[model samples]
Target: MTLNSNFREAYRQAQSQDVIGPNVIPKALPFVGGGLILTALGVYGGLGVISNYPNAFMPSFWVALIAEIVLFFVARNVAEKGNNATATPILATYSLLSGYTLSAIILVALSTSGVGLPGIGIAAGGCGITFIAARQIGSNLSDRDGMALAQTVQLGLIALIVVLLGQLLFSLFGIYTPGWLEFAISGIGVVIFAGMAVVDFYIMPRSYKDEQYLSAALGMYLTYINLFIFILRLLIAINGGGRD
Candidate 1:
């Protein structure tokens, strides 16, 4: 079946159902936990590889980024089709590949004087708080309101993509960015992704059935990863400003 049809069916089921079918959180936790563990392993392995062959970092990052993009789309397709068996492994692969890409940034932060531990700590703490608050807000939202929030988040995500594309182009052309502008952009990213996380969390229980745990887990995992990246970037910007 087409992706649209899959979504429509899921929506219909959500609208018709009253009780949140079997606690999704319990089933989802294992996938989330396992994905995170793999991600950590990937990141540490990436760091080691990069340290041993400094020149490979850029190439490795690009390769991992491309792999992640492909795997993400595949995983989404599988999950939307309710193929949890296929989706689970694909999601795990995407998470690991993402960690490989992220290791480059982590290395940069570590190399920067006085920006290592403190920046990581702040970003991790911020993500934790954001996740908890988002869960509370999502759980309280009615189904209709949660759907509305999801639409708003979709638009926000599109705008964020455009902004990120612009940044990429500017960087490609070696355009000089003001310190404040860089900070502002990163701050905006953090806010947008945090909001997206809230929407994702809110919609899972409302939109997905209990058996669609893989789909729900994938959505949450993506949000968490993006949130961490944005928060890390924001901290890095703050640290850079302090130095300047």
Candidate 2:
């Protein structure tokens, strides 16, 4: 079946089911909170380790990135199959690793230019505001509307992927990226991730069981991290690239 059709079926199924007591949001909050805490700890720990042993950056980045990817898929699969016990730990680990990766990027930007901290602040504020607005908008959307928004966001993501690949190819060819192009790509990333956050929030109410809150939190956390990274890059670009 087509993606839209599949969405419709899921929506229908969700609508038909009798929702039990204790809403998904409340159940999800603790997991999300815990994940955020772990993320902060990971970022701090990574920064400390990287500061003391600068040589470890590349290895740590690769290891964290790879481990996070693996754990995310495993956790998602387990969550979908209703194995919350296993999924929760995996999700937590993924979040922690993600934070570590983020710290590396932040530190790199800081070392490169003075815009780093300001960029981070702006990104955090933007993410907070966007998330709140998106959640409100999502909570008010009908399932059909939510599905439509999801499709639109998916298309945006495809465009973002294209931009990313183009940038990668440019880098591989040792071509100099124009400042305008860097700014544009980063802007697109920010917008796409923001839209994705909205869609994610919109679908969450109907997507998972209360017991699967960890999975839901994981989704939100991913969106937030992506948004932060894009925003940070955009800010750095505005400040004239990350170069001393």
Candidate 3:
């Protein structure tokens, strides 16, 4: 089916548009905030290790990266099964590991001439702004608008994943994306995740029932994290694309 038709079929029956889980968003918001804070702590710790014991940083980073990937699937599975007790620590660890891996980009941003702390702040502020706007827009969307927008962003996300995979493959061969392509990729990433920030507000209510708040929280956290990464990437691309 065409995207619009598919959305129409899927969401037409979900006519209420009211959030399925009234408590989900409220409960998830706190966890989301806590997760981000933990991520910041992880980044701080990672930065220290990288600066003082640079050799140790790479091995530790790889371990953390692998663990982070594993934890994501583990936590997601537990959360979806409504095992919040089991998922909570797993998700927290995932967030911290995520931040540790992210420190590499944070390091790049820090070293870039014009994309230092201020750029990080801007990227963060952008997410905050997007959240506020999306909450308003996505929460009130009619079934049609909400589903259409969600599907569009879903397509964008799939495309983004494929592109990122391609970039990773090239990197393995020591071929980094050029400055111009970096701008294109980063720009597209920023746009797609910004769109996802909106879609999350719409999808959560329909996708997760009231009891699945932990799963909902994980979804929101991923959206926020990806959005932050892309915005930071854009800043780095603009200021000093080839430097890193």
- List ranges where model 1 is wrong by over 4 Å: 1-22, 241-244
After TM-score superposition, the amount by which residue 176's alpha carbon in candidate 2 deviates from its true location, in angstroms, is 4.7
Go through the candidates in order and give each one's C-alpha lDDT. 0.71, 0.72, 0.79
Position 100, candidate 3: lDDT: 90
Maximum-lDDT candidate: 3
lDDT of 1 by residue, 190-228 (tens): 877787767656656666667778777776776777777
Q: What TM-score does each of the candidates earn?
A: 0.85, 0.84, 0.91
Q: Give the TM-score of candidate 2.
A: 0.84
User: Residue 222 lDDT in model 3?
Assistant: 82
In terms of lDDT, the poorest run of 10 residues in model 1 is 1-10
For residue 157, model 2's alpha carbon misses the true position, in angstroms, by: 0.6
Question: Pairs clashing in candidate 1?
Answer: none
Candidate 2 lDDT by residue in tens digits, 73-174:
787778767788888888788778878877876775676465766767777899989988987887777767877787777777667767777777877988
For model 2, the stretches where C-alpha displacement exceeds 4 angstroms are 1-22, 112-114, 242-244
